[model samples]
Target: MPQLAEKVPPSVAGAVLRAVFALPDPVRRLIAGRAVVRDGQRLALDAQLLLLMTRLEGASLTGATVPEARQGLARGQRYINRLPERPVRTRDLAAADGIPARLYEPKGLAEGSPLLVFFHGGGWVIGDIESHDSVCRYLAVNAEVRVLSVDYRLAPEHRFPAAADDALAAYAWAVENAAALGASPEAVAVGGDSAGGNLAAVVGAFADRRPDFALLFYPATDMSVRRRSRELFADGFYLTDADMVWFSDHYCPDVERRTDPKASPLLADDLSGFPATYLVTAGFDPLRDEGEAFGERLREAGVRVAVRRQEDLIHGFANMWGLGGRFQEALAEAAGALRTGLL
Candidate 1:
């Protein structure tokens, strides 16, 4: 990858996608029609927009140049940037270990609002704080809590424990620095989508004060084994089994290491004291089975758990609230649960 490859601003990718978005609906449906979720459930109108993003993000790049993947990811970042903006005061900061993070404060939050430290999903490879900005803003306003979006290191460049380490460090930073940030240690929560969700689950097992609750949206819990969802939703969906393999390969690389408790929280022998969790799963996501499996494990361990399965939604729907049917419903369910638990 050339140094100039990094210089290709995300805005260019955004513009290209904006043009694609501006095209007639018939054209979009044609180019992206193949992005069908194999489960027989049609992608709703709003959910269909996510396929356009999937197309823009460029699939089939496992063995390709890093620049190609970067370019593809940039388009998704732009797609996130294009989501509706809501009222939230934001600031850029760093975690305790100096990992970059963005803080979003919803306007008119009650004094001493609860705080949520969030991690974005991209299989620990592509997504950044920018990619999940809209979801964070929506959470902040709707849940009435401030959110710290951690921009942890990615794979191929930084692998395995780097992301896990940063996630723990970010959560620690929030709890330790809660007072100054207008949140309390008791009210602090950690959550994420996909890879971020996996990190949240891992961090909950070791957090100092322990997170009060967890919000995991279709997290990849047991990468060591192939499950039913993977076989069932392997192709056509926004997130495919091949994509999961690509992600796990880049992030963990070492097959044996994928079973590490930190990498695969579901493999943990003891989860007795883990925080209450709201585990979300999209019916069409390849990782759905594992996410649910983790939830069942939590229940077996006596940890309170709420599982919401969005049957008609696909992977990445949590990040696509603009497609406001089941996607928004899922988001609302999680936010409402968090408000009840944290506030």
Candidate 2:
């Protein structure tokens, strides 16, 4: 059964949200309280209002059971993610090792369009294809490429390395079957947000057959370290420290194993041959510093890297397209990067 929040109809929720956000900027700012300034970045007004609304609703992922957390995220996605009704065709497919996957192909794409193998973010524990359906759709239509959204196995049930293994397998499957999917075999990219971003980076770092490009959105690179951003945005920033502990506990229970390169790809020895990459980090996200550090490491290793810091956004802004503010703007830049990189 779904939670009470999940019971709210998406239409009703959407209407309420649209009305609330339609409030004047000054009113919204007043309601959201004073400006949140940290690390020399002011949180965007829209993001501030969203955070305030989330808190007002008393919703949180920190203390929920696994099922409850998943339900909460499902409800949130339903409320905030507006699916694009563009002429993209979707088909269910099985990825490598029979993992469930969905392919999003925009209408009238060229025979050799690029394909992005995307993993949905949920700390490797909660998220699935449905939670990120709109993200793939937006990317497909805007980037003018097909997207393979991989439903990778989650944590507690699958544990450390399972999600990474599945991500690599799914990406490999996309690369191998690109032509069949009407995608160019040589132009497959790997991407994801948050935990999905971590998995994408892992695939880029360790896969036998390299991806042509990598699009990472605030990936959790060095899971073993407690970085400055983690301390700065540890609480009230959507992804709290308690939430991280919960996710890490479920995904990688063995403290000793957290340092493994496959588990913490930032610790990987060689990032030399990684494909051209665009890594985006949220200014207010706990993972921001580490993600930027990974981009620096990639650059140092001779990988072509572009790192964009959406300083006004939060960790999960990639899924906030329904809000139609800075979230959509940030995503549009990312899509443009993908289109250019794959060309």
Best by lDDT: 2
Clashes of each: 0, 0
Number of the top TM-score candidate? 2
Model 2 lDDT, full chain set = 0.90
Scored against the true structure, residue 3 in model 2 reaches a CA lDDT of: 47
Model 1 per-residue lDDT tens digits across residues 115-233: 99999998888878877888898888888898999999999799999999999988998998887787766799999999999999999887667899899999989979999888988
Alpha-carbon lDDT of model 1: 0.80
Clashes by residue pair, model 1 = none
**How does model 2 score by TM-score?**
0.97
Q: List the residue pairs that clash in candidate 2.
A: none
